[model samples]
Target: MTDKIVESEAPLTLVGGGWADRALLADLRRHAPGIVAADGGAGLVLASGEMPLAVIGDMDSLDDAARARIDPARLHRIAEQESTDFDKALRSVAAPLILGAGFMGARRDHELANFNALVRHPHRRCVLVGMDELVTLAPPDLTIDLHPGTRVSLFPMRALHGWSEGLHWPIDGLDFAPDARVGTSNVATGPVRLRFAAPGMLLILPRDALDPLVRTLLATPGAWPAP
Candidate 1:
């Protein structure tokens, strides 16, 4: 995938957790070389036998050991409490593609809020990674490069109004409400190209499906929102 960290094999990113911090770090290192810790995530970074390029978020959650173990140059703390550590991690990294975990599964509010954050950012090339699936919001007025057999899900954060050129169930002139009218388990039709008149949100899984996804993006130009 274009957004993936390691290109040699299956590109994946592992996000460390506060509980399984040590275990998850090791697991990620074994699988994917690109692993990042957010705030308290440095704990696992040290134990993982690798140094994180950046340790992000406000210093509130970070402890003395986490700070001492990681280098100061790589650390970026956002004193803005209005934003979250997750947002800090997202902003700090320049990775065109991202894979994340432990971002969810902590608290209900944290999980739900993080999911919403993914929608809010709407990075043209990013994945809100998890144990189950990979997620990303589609760029406004653009096509999604996906494999013909790839699966997709369209979840409306606020209210969605758009149509699609290719998908198992192409939505059109439809108003999608949150928690309802959510699109899921859709099979890709050729290269998935979604031309959205208005900005909208969408999720995708790139495993066993990323090949076509990359090819799709190669042919289609990306969309940029009006500032």
Candidate 2:
């Protein structure tokens, strides 16, 4: 069973120790009001003049001053060294949707691990927000309204096959795999719809599409069962 550290009916914002600025945090808060930090992310949250509802991680990156500022009750430490702090925080949050910031930029490996976490925790409905784009693990099925000539990219963490509509090229019979076939730089002709046979497909879209994507994900009936 998953141990939930923070549960919310509304969309929640998750902060990490990566590259997140005040402007980005403020924009994310408009959609996801509640904030939670991952390890040293507590410092970034505090610097924004906002208190995190809970701080979840291995507690190594959290500094003395930031630790002293946060209430002891809100600090959650997971000693396991295998998973990244992004994985820890994503698993601990139980919300309709999660808007993640600070998980991208700075380190290339960390950004890649963020994508790995999205595929690892397929059941978690979360989106990682970057400066120019948004990334999320595509559910079994997803539909979103997009303007003509909008960019839509699909990357597979595991080998999977899927179908698409309103794309410049159809994906009905195409094979997708990380080592071999990957979908990127696809343009949407209009409103786009997609369905995959399994989990592990990551969807990348422009940063401006965050609101619509969140609405579509939440309104979708069911999610892929926890692996």
Best by TM-score: 2
Candidate 2 worst ten-residue window by lDDT: 1-10
C-alpha lDDT (0 to 100) for residue 101 of candidate 2? 93
Off by over 4 Å in 2: none
RMSD of each: 5.7, 1.1
lDDT of 1 by residue, 105-153 (tens): 4676766667666665655345554444555666665565565777777
Q: Would you estimate the TM-scores of all the predictions?
A: 0.72, 0.97
TM-score of 2: 0.97
Q: lDDT tens digits, residues 131-193, model 2?
A: 989999999999999999989999999999999999998899999999999999999999999
Mark the regions of model 1 whose C-alpha exceeds 4 Å error after superposition.
Answer: 1-36, 141-150, 206-220
The local lDDT score (0 to 100) that residue 33 gets in candidate 2 is 96
State in Å the error of residue 40, model 1. Answer: 1.6
